[model samples]
Target: MDRLTPLSKPDPVVTLDEVKANLRITHSEEDVLLARLIASATASLDGRDGALGRALMPQRWRLERDQFCYGIEMPLPPLLSVQAVRYLDAAGIEWDLDLTDVVIVGTDPAVLRARTIWPTVLAEPGAVAIEFTAGYLQVPEPIRTAIIRSVGSLYVNREAAAGAAALDFSGLDPYRQWAFG
Candidate 1:
């Protein structure tokens, strides 16, 4: 089984001020609610649990696997860099693989290609781990628009039925990882 853990999360993609401006909100009475809504909007589209299957802001993640292979697929991309590749030795001791031994291939759904043979590891679950950063340093405009529109819909229909706030998310189709590969 493969497991992905967020080592650190990115700052909110859209700020409270930005959301407020989008909604034309001029009062501070709903600042707290708007802040929460901003977080909610970012969470709905930011990282692994996000619909896009990619990170919107730069963030760190650790991906673990049972064993090392010639190549490993890194999820949540727009991969920025790989910090380290590690494995648990047969004796249950953690060891870091040489950085020069591997290469990062592609951006979205980046692949880690081993330049040499993989090291031996214990026969156990999550014996190999790769720490890396993925996401955009500057988020695309369409994504920002989507988040703003989503927050607007959520704010406007807070009391109505679910379908009442129907949002046309056709603008976000291009960002979905599946759309690229």
Candidate 2:
């Protein structure tokens, strides 16, 4: 693994209005603070468990690999599509691999398999670049509820006692990604 860069991020799963309503905030006094918290919480959740909630919104990511292999597993889950696969040769020239040569194998942490030819890459870091899209168009109810609960908890418990847990994410366990070795 070299670099996993986000080309585009999905629209926020929870809107400002929805969060405000959940917080029962009628005024705009804390709108900025709430908005910041919402973004922070969403990002935290998005990256949690290897981007479990990424399916709630379609996002594009660029994955850079140090070398080319027969199969490559993307870092994120719920892969929507592979945009392109390009590699840098030993001569420092870049070439695009045929899209038809690549196949998506699994859903959770989608795996890409090379069909006929696997290109040789430079013997350096970031020698291969794969751009792909993942995530969902609509947010799930459970995930939305979890976000709301987390935002509300953070808002209410901005100043929690030492050693106290601020938010309860137990409800999100069902939707969370569990890794198996």
Candidate 3:
């Protein structure tokens, strides 16, 4: 896998229509794919790595920029989360916890776990503006518990994903009561 931060080319620019076509909305009943696509494309850079993955991953792709710091990442999963952490552990990362972003693998029966056993990011004031790719979430306590155990963290319950489009961003808080409410 290649580092995602440093790029031979810019992050893939996605269109509203493109994301819309492939969008499986979870929270809102309106079109919000463009926002997600934009966020994903932006987050795919290495510039954001210094602060995000500085201490977590030992050897990271390094770069300097005025607008944004860049770092190349080995493509792992939907997020730089638990899935990547698990892979990194096997690939020789010399760490027990990542404590970064939520590790989200896929949209299907997707797995979500906190990157760190005890999140340094979550404790910080403005670590990351959390977002769920598959959107809405409403899993059973058992499943949530399993995921929490995977990352040595806890679950932040969320609504379920939608079909047509999204009205707004959901899963922004630990409580899933009013993201799109």
Task: Report every candidate's CA lDDT.
Answer: 0.84, 0.76, 0.28
lDDT of 3: 0.28
What tens-digit string does per-residue lDDT give for candidate 1 at 1-181? 7888999969888888998898999999999987877777777777878878898999999888999877787788799999999999999999999999898888876788888788889999999999999899999999988888887888887776773344445678888876321
Query: How big is the positional error of residue 118 in model 3, measured in Å on the Cα after superposition?
Result: 45
**Over the stretch 1-181, how does candidate 3's per-residue lDDT look in tens digits?**
1223332232323334434444343444444534543443323221333112211111222221111012222222123322233221223333333425445445323344554442232222222222222211233333223222221111111132532122222232332222110
Candidate 1 weakest lDDT stretch, 10 residues: 162-171
| Poorest 10 consecutive residues by lDDT, candidate 3 | 149-158
The TM-score obtained by model 2 is: 0.85
TM-score of 3: 0.19
Q: List candidate 2 segments past 4 Å from native.
A: 48-56, 161-164, 178-181
* Each prediction's TM-score versus the true structure: 0.92, 0.85, 0.19
What is the Cα-based lDDT of residue 111 in candidate 2? 79
**Rank order (by TM-score, best first):** 1, 2, 3
Give me the overall lDDT of model 2: 0.76
Question: For residue 162, what is the lDDT in candidate 2?
Answer: 33
- Judge candidate 2 at residue 4 and give its lDDT: 76
RMSD of each: 2.2, 2.8, 17.2
Report the C-alpha lDDT of model 2 over 66-160, residue by residue, as the tens digit: 99887787665678888899999989899998899898898776778888768777898899999988786666788777778878988888887
